[model samples]
Target: MKQTRTVRQSIVVSAVLLSVLFFLPLAVIEPFRAELFGRETPVEESEPEVGKLDGEVMLQVLNGDMVEEMNLGTYLMGVVRSEMPASFEEEALKAQAVAARTYTLYKIETGGNHGDTADICTDSTCCQAWISEQSARENWGDQADTYAEKIETAVRDTDGQVILYDGAPILAVFHSSSAGLTRASGQVWLNDLPYLQAVDSPEPEDAIPNYYSRAEFSAEEFKSRVMQAYPEADLTGEISTWIQNPVTDEAGSVETVTIGGITMKGSQVRTILGLRSACFEWETEGNTLIFYVTGYGHGVGLSQYGANEMAKEGADWLEIVTHYYTGVTVGPYTPAALQAP
Candidate 1:
C-alpha cells in the first residue's frame, strides 16, 4: 500500500513539473514576440511624380521692350493661344503645343536669332508669335474663359513633350493653311529637310476663312514695286512681255518668273508684292494686274486648318504630328538635352 501511494505521488509531481516547464518559456517569450510583431507595421506607399516642365524658359517678349521669363508650360500656353485659333479642336491644339515646344527648343539649341542675350523674340515676322494670358483673354472677349481653359488644357495635356527626329528636336515650322498640299522645305526654304518634304493635306476649303484671295495692282504700281527692288530691270515694254516664262511647282505655286528680264523666285515676288502666298494666277486686265492667290503663309510644314480637320476625323495629337512631320518621334522634353555645346 505505501509503495503504491509513493509511486502515485511521484507521477503527480512529474506531471506538475512538465506543465510548469512548458508554460514558463511561453511566458518568458510572450513580450519579445509581441515586440517583433509590433515592429511590423504596414508600410505606406509613396505617390507618383507628376509630369511638369523641367525648367523655366526665357522669353524676350517685344511687349513694351520688356523681357518676360516664364515656365516652358506657361510659354507654350501663350504660344498656342496666339498661334492657333482657340476655337480649334482639342487634338489640333495639342498638336500645335507640341510643334511650338519643339520649335522653341530647336531655336534655343541653334542659338536662335536673338543673339546671346535673349533666347527668342515675340515678333511674328521674325520668330513665333506669343501673347500674354491677359492679352489673349482680352482678344477673346466674351469667349475669354472658355478659350483660355481650352489652351491651358492643351498645354497641360502635352506638358514636357517635343517632336524628335534622329534623336534631336526638329525645326517644326507650321502655317495657317495650305494649297491642298504642304510645300517641301527645299521648295520654300534654302535647304530641304528630309522630314519637311511635301505632303498632301486634304481639308475642306471652306474650313479656312479667306482660303482664296484676290489682289489687284495698277500697272504703274506693279512697275514701281518691281523696279524698287530691281532698279536695273528694263520696263519699257508691254505688260504681256513684262512678265513671262513662269514656272510653277506641283502645288501651283510660282517657282520662278521673268520680271523685266530679271528672273525672281516666287517667294521674292510674294514678299515684294505683299501677296498672301506664292501661289497666284495673274492676268493683265487693261492697265490693272490682278492676282488670284490661294493659301496663306510659307506652307513648309504642318497646316493648322488641316490639323483641325484631321482632329475632327478622330485623329489624335500624336497621329496628327507624325502625319504632318513625317517619320518623327514624339518624346519627353528634357531641358538638359536641349542645352547648347
Candidate 2:
C-alpha cells in the first residue's frame, strides 16, 4: 500500500520524457502524440473496414502513410517487441505489455492527436514505436519464433489489463534507464503527476548499454550550438566559467543549469548538446568542453532496465508496475462505449 503523501509532496516537480522507453531504448520521446521537431504528419484519412469483434479494443496505428487497425492483443505484442527486449524476464515483458496497453487507452481517451488519420503512430517521436510481425521477425532472425512466443505470452497473460489510477487509465510513460534513481513527472514536464513521482530505480550502470558516454566539443563548436539555441547566452568568457550553478533534483537529474550566463533546464541543454540524459558532469580540457553523461532518456516513470532488474530479482509484473508507477491498480478495462454494439 502507498503511504499518504503530505500536501507538500503532492505539488512536487516532475521530469518529462524521451524515446527512452521504446525503440532503441537509447533515444528519448514524450508520451501521447507530442513530439520533438515536427513529428506529426498530415495524412489522408482512408476509409477502413474496422471489423469489430465482440469486446476487443481496436487500435488505428499510422504506419508511414497507411493506418493499420488491429486488436489490442496484437498491437501490444508488437509494441512490447519493439519497446523492450524479448530476452528480458517474462515478468518484465508482462510489465511492458501492461504499460503499453494503458498508454494506448489513455491516448484514445484523450482524443486522437494524429488528426483523423490515426489514433497513434509508428513514429517513436510522435507516440510509440511499433514493428510489424515481418519486421520483428527479420530483426529477431533465427530466434524469431521463441521471441515471438515470449512477447505473445506476455500479452496473453496480461490480456486486457491496464494500470489505472483512481479508476482511470494513468499515463503509463517509461524510460530506458536512469542515474540510479527515477525522476518525478514535474521535473521533466509541466505537470507533476501524482503517479509519476521520483523513486528508487536500482539499475546498475554496467548492465545498461551506453549508460556512460562522453561528448567533447571545441570551444567554438560549443559556442555555436549554444548560440543557436540561446542567443542571450554569454559565451564570451573563459570556457571554464561558461556553465555554472546547476540545480539538481533528488534523482540527481539537473533541474536547471546556468549555461553561458543564460538559465535553462537541464533537458534543454541535453537537447542542445545531444546528450543521452540530463545526468552529466562537465569539464574543460584545453579548448574543448567535455561532458560525461550517465544513464539514458528522461528520468521519469518506469525505468525499462530497472524493471528488468526487478523482474530478475523475482518481482511479478503487477508488483513491478505498481512499484515504479506509485499508486495504481492492474485490471481489465474495456469500456461499454468501445464494445461492439
Candidate 3:
C-alpha cells in the first residue's frame, strides 16, 4: 500500500509539472510574440497562405511590365510572414515554403542579381529637373538599402524573374510628379543610379529639358514673366528664348520664396515658379486650373511615403500591398503547382 501511494504521488507531481511548463509559454510568450516579429498579433483563427500561381501567370508577370520599384527582398519577407499563421497550418506553410524555394531558383537562373549599382543620381541637382523633385530625393535617400531588401524578398517570394536587356537590369522606373499619366518628366535618370552633384538651384538655366511638353510652356511663360518684372525693356524675338538662355556676368534680381516651410531665392519670375505660384496655368480635367499640387508622380502602384505611412500605422505587409495595388491576389508562384500534376 505504501509503495502504490508513493508511485501515485510521483505520477501526479509529474503531470502537474508538465502542465505548468506547457501553459507557461502560452501565458508568457504568445501574447507578445508579434512584438518581436514586427507584425500585428495573430488572430485566434489561422490565416492560410494563398495557393501557388500558375506558370503562365508568373511568365505573364515577368514579360509584362508589372513591377513595383521597391526592395524585392524586404517585400518577400513581409509576404511570407503576413500569409503565415503563428500556430502553423500545414498546407499553408508548405505552400509558402515551396514558393520561397522556387523563387530562389528563379532569381539565380534569371541573373537578376541585386549587387551592382548602375548609375543612380539622387542629388537634388541631378533629379531637380524632375516634376516631383522632392519626392525623388526622399525615395532615393538613405533608405535605399531598406527598399532594396524589400524588393529582393519580393522577387524571391514570387518566383518572379527580372529581364536583363543588353547585360543591364531592365529598369522599371518609379518617379514622383510624372506630368499626367505619362512617366515623362522634366527630370529623369538611369533607374539604378544614385548620387548627383547639385550644379544650381531650381531655375530655368539649371533646369533640365522638359521631357513631356518640351519647352512649350516655358517659352510661352518666359517673355511674359520677364516683361512683368521689367516692363520698360526692349524685349525682342521670343521671351522663351531669353528664359532658356543663362543670365551670365551678373546675378538677376533675387527674391525670397517659401515651399513647405523651406525658404529659397531666385529672380522674381524664377522664385514664383519655384514657389509654384500661378504664373502659368494648365487647362485640364473640367477646365479648373488646379494650383495646390500635393503628390509628385502618377499616383499608381506603391506610394513610397504612403507605404512607409502604412508601415508606421502598424499595418502589415498584405495590407500595405492591397491598399496600393487593387485587383491583385497575393500568392506564391510554383512550377509543379502550375503544371498539370
Best by TM-score: 2
**Which stretches of candidate 3 lie above 4 Å from their native place?**
1-292, 334-341
What TM-score does candidate 2 reach? 0.82
Stretches of candidate 2 off by over 4 Å are: 1-55
Clashes of each: 0, 17, 25
Per-residue lDDT tens digits of candidate 3, residues 1-341?
99999999999999999999999988898778878667885569422222233223321112112333222232333333433321222222223333333333344344433323311111223211111223333554775445433433343444433222333222222222212221111112223122111111112211213322311234335445545655554445533223222221121212233322233333233333443221222222231222232233322233333444344456554554434333334443333322333
Whole-model lDDT values for every prediction: 0.83, 0.83, 0.33
Tell me the tens digit of each residue's lDDT in model 2 across 154-220: 8887787888989988899999999989988887878999999988987977788999999999999
Global fold similarity of model 3 (TM-score): 0.25
- Which regions of candidate 1 deviate over 4 angstroms? 1-51, 54-64, 337-341
Best of the two (2, 3) by lDDT: 2
Weakest 10 consecutive residues of candidate 1 by summed lDDT:
46-55
